[model samples]
Target chain A: MVKRLSVLDANRCTGCQSCMFACSRRFGVGGLAYSAIHVRSVGGIEHGFVVIVCRACPDPPCAKVCPVDALKVRVGGGVILDAAKCIGCGFCAKSCPYGAIFWNERENKPNICVYCGYCAGYCPHEVIALEELG
Target chain B: MDEYLKNILYIDLSRKRFWVEDRGSLFEEYLGGVGVASKILLEECPKNADPLGPENVIVFAVGPLNGLFPLASKTVACFKSPLTKSYGESHAGGRSAIAIRQAGYGAIVIKGASETPVYVAVHGKNIIFRNASALWGLRNSITVGRVLREIEGGAGVRTIMRIGVAGENLVSYASVNTETYRHFGRLGLGAVFGSKKLKAVIVSGKTMISVSNVKRYRELYDKIYTTSIKSSVMKKYHDLGTASNIIPLNTIHALPTKNLRESSFEYAENISGERLAEKYLGRRVACAHCPIACIHLAALREPYVTEPYFYKTTMISYDHELLYALGSMIGVKDTEGVLKLIDEVEKWGVDAMMTGTVLAWMTEAYERGIVGENEILGLKLEWGSVESYTKAIEYIVKGVNEFYKTASKGLDALTSRYGGEEFSLSYGGNGMPGYHTGPGAHLTYLTGARHSHLDSAGYSLDQETLKGKQLSEKEIAEKLYHEESWRQILSSLVVCFFSRGIYTPETVCETLDILGYSFNEVELKRLGEKILSNKNDFKEREGFNMLNQRFPKRIFETPTPFGLLEEKTLYESVKEFYKILKERARNS
Candidate 1:
């Protein structure tokens, strides 16, 4: 079984959003045009950072709310985006509690994580990791 | 593209008017940020403009890669330094780069001095100038940041850049504090700000950037990003940050311990990164878009002596410069004690490096009886004594007495008055950096533009050369000259000198290509040479005479980790380098 992508420990995060950039870069876009994850300060940066990404709920709201069926749950990964099927409804983005789903207006589609674990590889601080859970 | 939005914002506070100028030619020639700022300063800023006068414009610029790339988000401040009176430029990573880029402008040039205290808040397209009489004379930097944050609209997006009391008082080495922790430190741009009567500048912009080739840009960015994160060069910075250098510097006996009187400290380990992480490391933060969060915040959680239920944790950013300055420079052993002093200095908005150097000088003066107990304003000056130093730092900030006044001016002023030029620890009128490595470091500081360690990082080169035996005077001079010349590109790109390996000449050329500019290796070298010459021209026009250059004899007397530096050879080598620079300038 493959694992989902999430930041395991917040303390380890340097608040360097290489993870966000990696996700955006994997989508073949410049800037944070189509990244699904967001890293922000908890309150004051002195307090540290909070990594907000999809938990890949059992009944994924992002997958459920996609009217065009663009977002579908993969066997191991939480939600995968079929760019061709996305109708730019932005419903999946609104439904996600964590606001993990990102919509690029230029492309007019919702960007969801495929749980490829590529971003984890780039995190030198080990803030992000892939772990299999029942 | 709208031309007005892309143009540089020029605000003259003395005249109380603003205008937008088309920098298309300059921007086309050298992209935005450090590149364009330097060119504009050279072109517009008169060679003889008073460093603290309204004629000297303070330029805050952002690059093409600023909001477009992950880690390239850094703002470069260009101004005639009140500290060095040379070509002064300082780069800081925070919301500054992103704010300027998003505000739909490349650079903001602030000229003239206001009649009264004022703060400019740039929110998107609207810029409002507010009277800051109430905010002026604030003791704590955090209070200034907090007040500005509340008053300014964009809580997360906006950056409140406020100068502390040190800047208000026109301390020669005052620094402008941004987002509490990050600073465009060095060269005293803060004093320039103070001279303008401009207390603070808050900026926020949410504008998106456009890429020339989105697909190709992404591919190239990932290639850089993947390798950048995984690069061995980044491992130390990413993991332990620059604070990790303390241990290594201690091992080499070149840590600038006790104002260079001693090369190494017995209490070095107490303030090292390992110990800090164990005792005080709270959390790490990044700049606007950088993924390599190399910033370390020390969590100072202490129980209130009077009220046990009421406790507060103060988070302070720890770096090598700060550690060396506040720790080893004054012989500080207690980590918390050092942090407390550092916090006080930051609250006052002075250059941490200058403050350390000044306090070190004062400590030495006390020991030598150059300054007596009466001159000390009743505060005891002692090494490894935080209480005395803390009071001294306050006195420096307030400019309370003759001692504070002299110290606040800088080491140069203090040394001249107190007859301690031998151990002043200043080069080119600026306070010294933490490099007692070798002659290369000293020469680099002596000759580099702005007299900063970042100009060439000659210490790194010196360390590399130490593997070989017997480096000639000429060899060292030439090496320093060449590296300092090339650093023009690094500052122009506004690239962090730490990532020199990542942004190689090839990568710089390639990155510029994506921005619709093309330059070969030769062209790049020529550009660097031209910028170096331009800087020299500015310095020469400002009455800088290389022949009259003074080297502190104390350095020669003190033995370094390398060896006891020979004064005659060092002085002669510097003269040769100075001659070379002049020849190049004349020919160019």
Candidate 2:
């Protein structure tokens, strides 16, 4: 069994960005420079918000786009970054259909969610959660 | 001071130049947001500068708590108001504060006038003045937003603030719409933007802020977050949004209706929050870092007459202010009717309260035979008629004729040109708020720096009176002064006022302590007072004489929740407020 983060319903998203803050706060600071999960309006906010994150594919396209074999597959459905091996091409950022791979501009590296489920806890509306896969 | 908190970005639109200056001591003294913005406004704006001229300054500032704490989620915009022709300030909640803070700037001051329309895109260390001549004549604010959303990046994190045709035409109460829902909705910020030919402002950033103490920081964050989620008041706010006040206010005879001819509405039940939520509540949104999702949008479906088979659904945001201003004030009884009117106002990006209040005045003037069909462009202005009102709103934005153009100038210009001075509802030259609570509400409108009801929240004082507590004029003035002065602290920290109950002085000190800033409760109080006096300094410097505007006669005519208001009581209260303000100004 493997655990993964999931957006239970984007319709419940309020655009508070608490989940984003929580994701970034895992780095022990309050700023949002390193958040993997993101939520954006579908054109305009009146239309409502859509939560974007890695859907955890069986074989992620981000791994294939990695020229340096920096992204290694985790046991579940996502890839884990090997920071030392990454050449910082940002191909993984463009390759991800969800645009979930956030970038670190200073270091030129990708920030991948570690399936910590920390963000799900901060979502006041129950819009996201952690689930187990069989 | 933190290095990032000291950076101020200055842009001159006339020269198309931009620069960053470090002002650590200013932020250290003032804290940021309203405090810093107000200080900058006083320094940058010339004496008797035209509100729409190149000399006027526009300051967008975020506080230290933004991007680091929950509900510290507002950007304070300080400028000279075209509407009041005096000191102007408005607070907007969206990603604005967070974006500005993250973008490596404490504040952004925009000066000078552009020959052609432009929108400034600001990010970390880069400010791009993009030509926006094409977007100048866009049909609506939403269209302008849609066009800019494609040109600018940072979809999730950035804030795009833009104005509509009303702003382009220098409507006195034009609003700067942000994120399609929230706005700098009062005091003519949009008009200021128009004067400078600034169509929009885009801000987003990539930055990391490390805390002084990570463990203590997380603890405080948890306390604040949990406290917000569990509070019943927050629950009420989240469920119904601010529209929850409609039924209660009507029942208490505090809801202003029919241009405040009556305090209560006959059809209040139809436009009540409960009804609107049950029928048309489409979505609930929140500002960045706010746990409470108080922004409510109603799904309004309209069918094209040519093709009745297909209907388009437009999402319109609503609150008690819009409910009272556009709904009850103008006599619109039904929920959908109010939504339609709000849609029109939102499209034009004018202050909805000002627009509705303006229409309400015109409606009464037309009915009184003060203005005939010729004055109203041959359209019969009727109360509660959304069709007529929508057309009137379009005319206001289009400046179709003399009356339509004068309509956007607000009550002063309108009353001066036309008769109906007695029934004209305004407070200190600005359109009146929806409250007819009592003298406290009236005093806040008159004596508060910006003439905003939120300045001291005197309605809260009126609620105490409703509970059968008798207070004297001096007591009321003292209370208003204390509360308003204290609120300067919250605004300086830039926290949402909704969480005032939760963020006590002790809690505030704890949060600040973890941020490497230490202040005792007494010191914090003094800081708040100092900041407030600075705002008053700006107001006085701009030559706004509070005694100039008298209360409209309709206030005494209409029976309020407190019965017919006594003119003597209001006069005495205003005098007391002035005395307090004078003493404070002298001491400062």
Candidate with maximal DockQ: 2
User: Residues B269-342, candidate 1, lDDT per residue (tens digit)?
Assistant: 98898898888887777776676777888888778999868988899888899888999989999899888887
Worst 10 residues of 1 chain B by lDDT: B1-10
In order of appearance, the predictions have TM-scores of 0.89, 0.98
Regions of model 1 farther than 4 Å from truth: A1-8, A19-29, A32-37, A52-134, B1-6, B155-157, B586-588
| lDDT tens digits by residue: candidate 2, A1-134 | 77888989999999999999998788887778888899899888988888987877788999998999999998867888899999999999999988889998757799888888999999999999988855
Backbone clashes in candidate 1 total: 1
Q: Which stretches of candidate 2 lie over 4 Å from their true place?
A: none
* Best model per lDDT: 2
lDDT of 1 by residue, A10-109 (tens): 7877666677667766755434556667776555567666787777666787888788888778665477789888888889889988877766655877
Q: Listing every candidate in turn, what is its Cα RMSD in Å to the true structure after a full C-alpha superposition?
A: 3.9, 1.4
Per-candidate count of clashing residue pairs (backbone under 3 Å): 1, 0
